[model samples]
Target: MAAACGLTAAATMLPLVLGGGSGDGARPGGRPLAQAPPAKAPGAVPAKAETCTDPEASLQPSSADGPTIDRIKKAGHLVVGVDQNSFRWGYRDPATGRLDGFDIALVRAIAKNILGSESKVTYRAIPTNQRIEALQEGKVDIVVRTMTVNCERIKQAAFSTAYFQAGQQVLAPKGSPITGYNDTLKGRKVCTATGSTAYDALKAKSYGAVFADTATAQRTVPNQLDCLVKLQLGLVDAVVTDNALAAGQAAQDPAVDLKGDPFTTEYYGVATKLGNDDLVRRINQVLVDYRKGGNESPWMKAYRRWLAADLKGITGPPAPKYR
Candidate 1:
């Protein structure tokens, strides 16, 4: 699961160091955190000439090495952009100060497949809004964070076949009256990460809820974990994020929990820059092998290790689909 002891200490000490440690809405230095200008939410991609219907369908699995593969081999290590705060998916273990989780395991699998060494990787902690930017700028070879595949994103980046399935859900304190993504949110402040699908959902239909942090001096934070912080500090009444991630947040803090069932279906994919067909195909091939072995598959083992405890009922990784 998580680094129990270290996470416990972090839960106790993080708020104290970050700002407000209590639910009284007090911030450090007696000044509220500044709200950054809003980033475009990474919801469904806009319609265009190349609009897609099946974003999960990717290039056929291939072991072939091409330009992107050659470049990565020449570099001798994989540069992966990931989130260091999303527990169970990807996070730096406070106990050992090493990255560990489901996504980290997949990154290591990719590294071992491409570089013949799992340890030969450099992780760059990227925020939600910058996933595509990092890849397009050649800052990272691939992004394995819980990035959802959709029509719009495919236009900007190539993706491997679906690896994990997730959906947006609500997270709130245990005793809160905010039941779910319903009218109960009327007039209540909700928190979501900037550029996240959750923000998009709220923007499309708020149910009388207030999500624009600028109006409340609480703009959305870059990381999903930051939403958990705001929830702890009473800055927002509920948090809307991926249920897979909300499970981790609930595990990290017993005071909060997922408030409702998932509202939409989405798939997680490993994203590479556009035209990185070689790398994308190679990753698809890796996923093909990674999904084998049934119950003993590496994917299932990872799920059991990190996710089963909090997010249950997953039988296996999503079947890979090819274009």
Candidate 2:
């Protein structure tokens, strides 16, 4: 949280020093503090609802029957879990001092569909490894943090239909002897975020790099961007992350380049605590409409704004698939 938003412990405490304001209302300086949106169980269902996934391919509209949706409506906002590091996906924009990126736009769309206002979103910055645990612990209502859906994660949380497609790829400094995910990694000090599939892949030795001896060379960090930082500071030889995120990191520093063709296929999904089928369904509904086809679609507009360049010619909101 502190790292992603660049907020210090003092940043949070400064709020308490200044006296009375409503939840996330005006502070002494009038800037709203990040606060949990006021909420409770709603007496009725929300009349306005929307989604960002392929609507033509989506199931019938979101029933919005879940207790989670009711609680969110009554609270008057949606609490969304997101990333503050991965570029173009969910990083904080320094120019505006606001979290802005592809994933964040999706989160805001969910807030709008459910709460009738995009600004009703309360952002929670979570690290890569903590995304699932945060959802289970109820730290945030739903995690839209570029989390990849996979069998191992399904046991921990319920996921909406796959909303975005990503793949594991290697990132390294430009002009480095390392050309890609190959023999070049035989003895390199590679870095991956703790709890990410990229780290798991390294642990499993799935990249075919034979170790000369049992000296641990893998570095792990809490956020994917930290690995990039390590690379920049000469702490690690390379970073492994989703192509979408790696693209963002590369943009952050032109000296770095996505080192190779993606080595794995993965899907991104909105996740909730296991068995929260209600919340899962509601989020799935958001995905469905958000991807509705056409240049006018919200998803496309956001893509053009943030990711079109990094992703190059790749087309679309990966076809949606339900549980």
Candidate 3:
């Protein structure tokens, strides 16, 4: 039920100009980018504590044959919720007009395993804010849209093992003096999509009380990529998103670059409906068995083709740990 062309219109995006791109972007664990993560702002209410299993913590395998499998087998297709503007994670390729990215690659593999055809699936383009609610509402069978696992989300939905590692970071114009996650944001307006970790990070004490009584970037959008549009239009000073996503945006627009070290480490997981532990277990096993083919693994091939350059040094799937 997915028309690749329709995803282009649904995705809130900034048109990319791919010419004369630079190779001098930031890299993790090496020459640092931006400033060291700032200390927690004094007396600012801390980010919500995750008292439950971390959303992206390592995932262990499980025997998944159950009703969920029977349901999918009966339907003969997988319905997946994903982002269309997340650049290399999940996006509509302007040239080919097809949905592609690292996450899309995973969807194809899961589809192949369950439905016997990689393309035997329906794509539901969901915004970041609606990811969990869509699952809870029974609107989709799986979500692979750079979703972070956290205690609050587990209350409503289930998540697969950690699939990708990410961290909250800043994006800004080429020569802006905003160094790292520091005072450079005093009078600056930043943008983040609603229902995102980046939005939550902005409110956390350490990243400056962005939403505090003080002056900060007060704008919120429906999609994280829209923040980049605000920056392009000079509507906001910068955009805050995961470094992984910012890397893709930077590639799309040479005018912007990742400005600082990622302030917090996070992980991305596949999300499914609550009480769908059978499906959850099945997905986790899929992840565990994804790369056994070694050099022929689809995960490696896609990463090398799309993500290796932007996310320097990433070479393999995240190791899984079972609960």
- Once fitted onto the true fold, the runs of candidate 3 whose alpha carbons sit more than 4 angstroms away are 1-60, 206-218, 293-296
> Tens digits of per-residue lDDT for model 3 on 182-284?
7777667778888887787776633442432224434788778777776777777788887889998887777789876766666678898878777887788
lDDT of each: 0.78, 0.66, 0.70
For model 2, residues 1-323, the per-residue Cα lDDT tens digits are: 21422422212221112123234322122212011111221221111111223321323347566777777777776666777666788765555567778888888888878788889876767778778767766666788888877666766887787667666778888978776666678767788888887776666553454322225544777777777766877877888777788987777677789875766656677887776667777777887788786666777788889898888664567666543
Q: Indicate which candidate wins on lDDT.
A: 1
TM per candidate = 0.85, 0.79, 0.81
Sorted on TM-score, best first, the list reads 1, 3, 2
Write the number of the candidate with greater lDDT, choosing between 2 and 3. Answer: 3
Q: Which candidate gets the maximum TM-score versus the true structure?
A: 1
Each prediction's number of clashing residue pairs:
1, 12, 8
- Count: clashes, candidate 1: 1
Give me the displacement of residue 302 in model 1, in angstroms: 0.4
Q: How far is candidate 1 from the true structure (C-alpha RMSD, Å)?
A: 10.5
lDDT of 2 at 73: 71
Better of 1 and 2 by TM-score: 1
